[model samples]
Target: MRGKLRHGNVPLRGIAIVAILLVIAGAATASATLLFLGEQPSPPQLAAPPPIPAPGPEPDHALRDGQPGEVGLNPAPIAAAQGQLAAGTQPSPGHPHPSYAGEVSLLARDGVVVSRQATGFALRYADAQGPELPAEQQEKTQNDTIFDLASLTKLFTSIAVLQLADDGRVNLNAPVADYVPEFAASGKQKITVQELLTHTSGLQAKIELWRLPPPARLPAVLSATPQNPPGAVYRYSDLNMITLGVLVERMSGRPLDAVVHDRITAPLGMTDTGYRPPRDKLHRIAATEFETDPPRGLVRGEVQDENAWSLGGVAGHAGIFSTADDLAVLGQALLDGGTYRNQRILRPETVRAMLTNYNTAFPRNAHGLGFELDQPWYMAGLSGPHTAGHTGFTGTSLVIDPGSRSIVVLLTNAVHPSRTWGSIGPARLEIAQGMALALGPPGHDG
Candidate 1:
């Protein structure tokens, strides 16, 4: 039984191929039979799926029972974001986003790209050598250029867990300890895999992995205990994907990076997305905001999440690098129910499961397994019950709207020199709004 996409009543399809052949005992016998009776021939039977229906109003909004409607980014909110973009210009009294070299923002709606603009690049801070990016290095900041997605790495981690569920190697409702025995050390023994995916695992939000001496970190994780009663509340915990990473490694018997690369990145042809980007590709890499607490002046060609860095830059929570183009493919794949270019990565039902909002009682952190559902302040006007996407603290986000059959990806080095400046919420939300405005709302009745 195949389930249709819950967001919209998108149809499901199946594909099968068959070939038929007949053998003759001998050439002489065949010739003799041909002279008498024509070779035995039977009409080959074949089957084909129905043609795709023209998209109309989505037929279903799959949810547990009563998932709330998501907020949408309106023209007003979008105008406000653009206002913020303008202020991100020459540092003025109110502008928070310092003009520390930004990317060109592009708004795409429907199948059309509506708006594109370059901003926040002229201003700069001293580099490790206290030198600014020369004019040549600045070319990659254009609209066509790609920005590295930071901790948004969790999106891939979530996909991996769903893949395991599809393979029947793991069950979302089952306790995660079924695979990673060490994860059961604390009271988390009874926590279901779904709980972790939804950030309701009761695990500590973070352990300051970078602060601990290298040898003590793993021990720290093994000894982690729940901060709240499991499944009783919602708490965004990096520990969730961290555990998932361990589970993926244990089940696949390969490092998380290898498993993700082979299953998610490589098959999708996301050539620009991977863990620890190669040195050859580093030249085009955008510089993240500098940091001094860890004694690292400016972070480039390195993982940004401290926990991921502590884990040697391949944690399930945050050790992948990707660009807008590569991740846009990922977004499109999700929109297509996991297949792109004739390669089926995820079944329609599985994709449905990922987008279903499981957090009903916990309202603030609305989420599904690896995907965040309907949050308007960050989602801007794009929030809807069927809307789903995720954000990385490193100025990266992916938003998919089943109703529009559209996706928006924004990548920036918002934290170019420090995490202190301000939230890049406007930038992320503006990109989605630009796309929405470009696409325009559907229907003529209004």
Candidate 2:
């Protein structure tokens, strides 16, 4: 019956089977074409790709008491760093004693207090060559103990000048002679206010301002001749700041200490910070070196900077006494863009200008207005373009990292026994590194 239905030789069933086989072959070819060239073959379904987490806001910058872990920091490293710092304060066998007699260190991460350590003695010393004192006579260091801020006073002077600038009383670009005609002497008439802050004013690094009478010191600083042409060199000179102190006074018509207190410390609530701490607070002040030349033995309750002392303990280059706690507030204020707790001491723009490096011509000297910028020798892990700080000759240091919103204050009486006790660079680096490590990487807003 299949052969009868067929037109020519092949049977109908045979033709049907042949057509089915051809249809199957065509489908295989079409599938191959789709798989390789025409279109994609259906593949196995996969689980949806995991959602990426979105970044969050920055961590809170208002300092509060918290453990390192609370601020997303590792506790072990911070503890280890503290231990190392403590060890550095003690005398090791075969190693000449500690870098400093005592220290008070505070570390904050994202404005959270992670560590506060007070070690050694503030008065466990005497003259460099004097016999060791009885332990009973030495006073142990405390967190609130006041320290002579030494060159850190420059920061205050710089702030005062900036405050004047903010008030429109001072012009940074104007020549010093504009505000201070006496400054025109010694060919310094062309020097600008900014040149002094950047330490590029070519002023001599130092003068025995003490050698001159108190009345004459100010004149001497003003009459100072530039060792190099103005803005030609980067020289960290106390005279530059001294001249600024004079400028601040001349423009504001107020004493340096008075202006710093009324405008800075008082507003910031830095109760324990100021020049010439009161007589009642003298006992808590660290003792500095013995100056036989000036006959100031175990110098205590007085400014440590010789020139500043000679100028009656209230000068621009030095003489401010402060505690680690007080200095932390100042550091935090700068990090907060010159305001703290609703009190705006400096405009944000002024703060930025003060911290912006102007000595780009001299890369090694990365100086902002009054703050030293990115000094690796002391800033350690905290050293960066945004890191700004200053080291006091009295062994006090302040390091502020805007990126981390962290502040590290290390106050020491390295000058307690003697200013010749060796450098505190090692201890500074170690302390700063510890704090930086605890904070980990930046932008960990969680």
Candidate 3:
């Protein structure tokens, strides 16, 4: 009787378990359909994270000498650039080319000097013919070697004019005659101060000032006629800066050099940059050109521009001599919006005006009040509307890219043997491109 009861209960229990399993399967299918149709259950909530803090300001505005990696620059590119400068000294037989005899290049990113190199000989020189010289006679270049700034002197003159404008001593829009009455002699009364700064003043590109007697050069420049109507064309003229230099002297009742020293260089602490470097510093000066016709042999320790040389090595357009380090300070000041080491050389608004494009009429020849703007030939990848720079005939160049707050100073004695040697423009662009590539992507908006 017990065995029969157990068998009957087993079938009843199995049927009840099967019914329970069917209910669970139906419920699971319903859940799967809901999940597949994008109807999943909600998850538990948690608090969101706090916001990130804003970055602080940089420590200083002055360029602090540091390693490339310290400023987030790649050292390889910079080293490669230095290697190129070193190779430039050697002559390749089949492909003989003109290159720097000596170069002092400095690259700065956000006011931190990442690379500073001096290569080749400051005086590995030759006479006007530039034949290779004995090594014993050569003077190796140093970081502090003084270089003739050449046409880069225009930047100083431009800054001085803008400084005077800031002081309310002159007006940018005023006619040139307003400051210098004699400047009106050659139908130039219509030319404005702005036109001279922008190189659209229509003045003749240059006069053989060296040909004229010392007393007559100034008069000739002042009385010279325009090549075209004022602002009607764009032609770079040394006479424009020369005339402005004279205007600076007349308006300030002081020499142009004195005004620049007392106003710009002194305030910026640029001790090695000025007109007529002292005789004591002559040992560190780079040799430039050997002019047989002019009887200047192994030109060194003096201004290289003929017009400036004729003017006693003190002119508005060309005359200033500077070291790579000294120029780095000036470049930093301009990149810092006219202030460096707590000294303000120009008002912020004035700096903005200086870097603003005043030459929309001459698109290819973009210019600021005292700087060249967006020049790809020299500025390279750093070229932009706000980029500023100047090139000197003596193979010196300064490029400041406001976009990156980066500065490149490439000083070469390309004119050492002779100005006839081809241009260093390609090398100039290379140095700037190396810096731009090293900085690479400008990591932050700050």
Candidate 1 local lDDT, 362-414, one digit each (tens): 55555766888766544544565556888878777888876666567766777
Cα displacement (angstroms), candidate 3, residue 110, comes to: 1.5
Each model's lDDT comes to 0.62, 0.74, 0.76
lDDT score at residue 398, model 2, on the 0-100 scale = 92
The runs of at least 3 residues in candidate 2 whose Cα sits more than 4 Å from the true structure, single-residue gaps closed, are 1-62, 441-446
RMSD of each: 15.9, 24.3, 24.1
Model 1 accuracy (lDDT, Cα): 0.62
Arrange candidates by lDDT, highest first: which order?
3, 2, 1
lDDT of 3 by residue, 1-446 (tens): 00011122121111121110000011112322222122343310111111111123322477788888777777776777677666665565553645768889999887788888898888976676667688888889999988999999999999898888777787776787999999999798888887899898889899889888999988999999998998888899999999899989989999999999999999999999899999999999998888765667778888878889899988889999998988999888876667888888876556666666666656777777768877766776566666789999999999987666778999998887888874577678667767766665534322
Better of 1 and 2 by lDDT: 2
Task: Identify the superior model by lDDT, candidate 1 or candidate 3.
Answer: 3
Candidate 3 deviant stretches above 4 angstroms: 1-60, 93-98, 441-446
Q: Judged by TM-score relative to the true structure, which candidate is superior, 1 or 3?
A: 3
Instruction: Determine which window of 10 residues in candidate 3 has minimal summed lDDT.
Output: 17-26
Q: State the weakest 10-residue window (summed lDDT) of model 2.
A: 17-26
TM-scores of the candidates are 0.76, 0.84, 0.85
Clashes per candidate (backbone, < 3 Å): 12, 0, 0
Cα displacement (angstroms), candidate 1, residue 111, comes to 5.6
